[model samples]
Target: MSDADLPFTAALYASTRTEELAPLPWPEEAKRMFLAQQHAAQHAHYQQHYRGMEAWIVEHGGAAIGRLYLHDMPGEIRIVDISLIPEARGQGIGAALLHDLFAQARLRERRVTIHVEKNNPARTLYARLGFTILDDDRGAYDLWEWRAAA
Candidate 1:
């Protein structure tokens, strides 16, 4: 396959132990821990529902550095989860990945939405991209969404 296809060739697997996710092709530095946790803790959701959820891989220099897990419904696309290793942050990987995903949503005419931990720095990134605050849970996260131009 061509290089462009290579990046899209990233693979995803479910976690059997509900623990750390299987490693991606990127370096450990690129996948830094978040919130004082291993930061690789979401693999369980992917593994358990592998058949139902769709995984999109994000790559840089032909190496997989992150992932975007989505839940697509009739009229909306929920960005159920996204992550970039610490090493990959500040290098524009997140923005690029998000842009591609949202663009896909726009093309399908689906409203795009996601949940973010209040303290995550990516919150600013989403805001800059025009996603607005919709609702929130007092505990830790807020719901955000972006709609197509009317």
Candidate 2:
């Protein structure tokens, strides 16, 4: 994503983060502030840990709806993150994107991996897409992997 996309991307991140934080009973305004801070920190963490990441802005009907960050290394294509706005979610957009990624990985003969929170609803989708747990011992996030049949 370009610098011009930062605000929109961050807003998308905040929306997804808001859903994850919904169970916490925090005041709306306070949650807003917390989400902003958390977004900045998470962005920084991604920058530091995954250099050369590719950030893509997900769009549909000529409007921005989400962000997908990938760390494409030699043997694996890691889904650094992927999220869609609440309204845009559960509409098969995410599954379509994953199918595209899987096709690309299949051609490249590379595996795909992602770390997702245990309770994230998207984990069900990932499982349905044939992503198996690689490491569930992770505190909150379990590492999942998928590869084409040999």
Q: Which candidate gets the maximum TM-score versus the true structure?
A: 2
Taken over the whole model, the C-alpha lDDT of each candidate is 0.66, 0.91
Residue pairs whose backbone atoms clash in candidate 1 = 14-47, 30-85, 31-85, 32-86
TM-score of model 1 vs. true structure: 0.67
| lDDT score of residue 95 within candidate 2 | 97
Q: What are the TM-scores, per candidate, against the unseen true structure? A: 0.67, 0.94
- RMSD per candidate (Å) reads 8.3, 1.3
What digit string (tens of lDDT, one per residue) describes model 1 on residues 20-133?
433455455444333113323445444565446776666679776666778887888888777665567678877887788778988999988888878777789999988998
Residue 68, candidate 1: alpha-carbon lDDT: 73
For model 1, state the Cα shift of residue 144 in Å: 0.6
Model 2 clashes, total count: 0
Worst 10 residues of 1 by lDDT: 9-18
Question: How many residue pairs clash (N, CA or C atoms closer than 3 angstroms) in each of the candidate models, in the order given?
Answer: 4, 0
